[model samples]
Target: MIEAFDLFSVEQVAFGTGRWEQLGGFARRLGSRSLLVTNAGDPGDGGLVDRTLRHLEQSGVAATCFRQRGEPRVEDVERAVAAAREQGCDLVVALGGGSAIDAGKAVAGLLTNGGSVLDYMEVIGQGRKLTRPATPWIAVPTTAGTGAEVTRNAVIGCPEKRFKASLRSELLLPRIALIDPSLAVGVPPHVTACSGMDALCQLIESFTSNRAQPLTDAWALHGIRLAARALPRAVAAGDDVEARTQMALAAVISGVALTNVGLGAVHGFAAPAGANYPIPHGAVCARLLPPVIEANVAALHAEDRDHPGLAKYAEIGRALTGTCDAASDAIEAGIGCLNDLVDQLQIPPLRQFGLTPEGFADLVSLARKASSMRYNPVTLSDAALTEILQKAW
Candidate 1:
């Protein structure tokens, strides 16, 4: 049987050591007036807000900066949209981590579309399809994680609803993705671990996803190999340019793959876990990935011995460990390798992050409702889900 799928990515990707130097020229082509969104706590840190403004100024483009304080929220998008509208900005440059890029994607969509961010969020909002083209947005990632630079959806956390949802549309894809691995040179080791694990999980899950297609599979496999070799090195020495560049490439590949083929239980659970706790999205993914992989393998074998994802896991095991084994044996070896990586990264358990058994019911229910859950190779029962959570705990 033939499977059909669609691929979406940013229009232009400029990836190299100092590609950020081209920002001014690119901004001029996009628009004369721009809005810049960044999550940097300080103006001088990896937060390139001031530098981005200088680039736009040098290009003769008028620019305004909105510094996002934390994770993207519904309120952040609302405020950014209003800022863009008031300043009459014509372009948006998101230069930071995932939060800034996600927020910029939302603001760009809402700026031209003329609606609140809630009008298009999944599960909790009207889920209206966005029809208008977004204002041209350029994404410059300061981190090597959360390929929001290329993905088509912005995750927004709504405090009032106590849930995190995504504002999605093809229009939300950025006009350009400018990835400079040098920007990640000084990122803290802890942040590196969490983000790197998220990138790795994205690659592994997408490769074995129910929606996996030949195109995504190719990307995922390559990304998995890169991440396996680079993530540890990057985490150990943040200044290692070679490792950082590989991790960045792996992250972008994972993002493109997940956007097309979808993710699995780790992200499915992370969505709700992140909303209910103060944990970072990447941290949530890191904590849950090993258990989710183990559970998926067990469930697939117990329920349907011939499910193809089982073999895919073996392939993943081979890709990660560079060891050849039978599919069944490889799956166990892969799980062990993943666990080793998790410990090496020092990904804390859910308990340390405030996920208690009392919260299990709501977490499981919300996890199931997440759109990502649909792509898991097997439908996990409530009991199975509980077991996975407990194991992670």
Candidate 2:
């Protein structure tokens, strides 16, 4: 018998090579004045942002620009919300990488909910529910990773508390996700590698998550296949439009899959690592993914060899290596493939990001409390978690 499951996703998705040109028309339908959230540094030599402003203006929608420098913080969301309110902006257009999109999502939620980020953020805050729908928001991704365009939660860090958490609600889903693969054609190779690895990790984790269901499985598997074929090409050649398009599609599929099934250990560690250290979110995932996979496979082998996740791991291996071998062989190949990818990408180790044995105990404690940990296929002991960290280091 099939199990019952629920799925959530963005209301609309406009994905293609030249879909960005439709942004102005989409915004016109949503609202008149827009809060345009983007990266602090110019993309496409400042032409992208300038063109976006022109598009909105041509479509008769006024815009006020807000540059997001890094990951979204509680204060940053508040400041953006204040700006939106002050400018009477009724629409939000997030255009850039994941950080900017997340910032825009949080601002849109707070604009209508009428409270500080702490009022609804999980773990580090009161964890209250949002009672109202967020303002109409559109996501225009310039990077082919993060898939923040379709996700329903915004990750916000609290520097004072030294933690990061999500301001989560179904209301935060974008009104439309407008993805134009051409926008990502000029992304730096290093950024492409990091983000592509992050997307791959999300797909693998979600596919093997304890909550995995048929719907999410379909999306995850397809995404994993696309990433397996496209990630290396995308990183090696920035101007390869076909590779960029494939990666972009894979990223959106990953976001949809993860939103429904949740993620596993790599993301579990990401929250604590990103909050306490200077590591980028993608870099953390890249550095830790292989070890976490090894740990989980070992735990499953020792205790629950028949776990569905084990077979899923073999499937992932097949996807990555294009091997039609037995389950055990396939799983090993998959793990080996990931290790090779990490070395090829040159993802920095945790130690390079200021992590050490001295702080392992603290990170383990915090990771245990992370929301993503609950979705790990097998419940791991603290010792196992520490070993994973040690291996990654």
Candidate 3:
């Protein structure tokens, strides 16, 4: 018998070298007025905002732009919703990285739903569901990470609670995901390495997640292979169009996979780490992924009962390492390969980012409450969680 599963995706998606030029047409169909959300970077210095505005304007779409500097916060989304409402914008366009896309998503939802972002957020709020459909949203990703363009949830950092949680709804998925891989050529090497590692972890965790189904497994496997082959090349030579394209494709695939199957321990810890510190989201995932993999493998071995997900790790090992071995042996080889890749990418230790003993303890407590932990392949003990952090440190 086949296991029951469901898949959710954006209404429309376009991927290629010059799809950026088609953003105007997508926007015009959505509405006459648009709100363009972007990072604070100047277009003259290689930003995509100026170009995006020009496209919208040429299509007779009136546009106003909002620039966000860092991760999307609850306050940022609130302010954006008010601004868009006051300006009478009818559509939302996210033109930069994940933060911008998440911010736009929140704005689009709140504009019609009529509530603060906290009202619909998970973990620290009422967790109310969105009753009304969001305004049409167009996601134009300039980075090859996060894959927020096609996701139905937006992560918002809550400063008051010192937690980062997701604001989610099926209605929050964008109307169009306008993906242009060539737009990622300007990303720096360090950023590419960090984000690529995030993509890699997302694929691995989702493939092994307790919620994984046949459909997500296919996407996750394809993403893992693509990321493994492309990440190093992208980091070493940022101008490689082929590598960038593969990583971009992998990132979106990882997003869709994780959305359906969920993630695991790496993201469980990374969310709280980002909330508590000034560290970048991708950096936290890069530092924690290998340790989480090792911990999961060890925990599975220690269990007296056989877990179905245990063999999945070996599959990942064989896929990533290109080796055929017994399940147990392949699992070990996969762990070693992940460790080597993390080191090769120069992902720093958690301690280097000023994570103190007290801070780590707080993070551990927060992670236990994280939504991502529910999908882990194995249930980890507090001691196990501590060991993963200590090893990563």
List per-prediction Cα lDDT, in the order shown. 0.88, 0.91, 0.87
Clashing pairs in 3: none
The root-mean-square deviation over C-alpha atoms between each candidate and the true structure, in angstroms, is 1.3, 1.3, 1.4
Q: Cα deviation of 233 in candidate 2 (Å)?
A: 0.6
- TM-scores, all candidates, are 0.98, 0.98, 0.97
**Cα lDDT for residue 98, candidate 1:** 89
TM-score, prediction 2: 0.98
- The all-Cα superposition gives candidate 2 an RMSD in Å to the true structure of 1.3
Instruction: Return the top candidate by lDDT.
Output: 2
Instruction: Tell me how far the alpha carbon of residue 75 in candidate 1 is from the true structure, in angstroms, after superposition.
Output: 0.7
lDDT tens digits, residue span 143-243, model 3: 88898888889999998999999989999999999999988888898889888888899899999998998988988888888898899999999989999
Clashes of 2: 0
What is the Å distance of residue 346 in model 3 from its true position? 1.2
lDDT of 1 by residue, 89-172 (tens): 999999888899999989999988987888899988999999999999899888888888888889999877888889988888
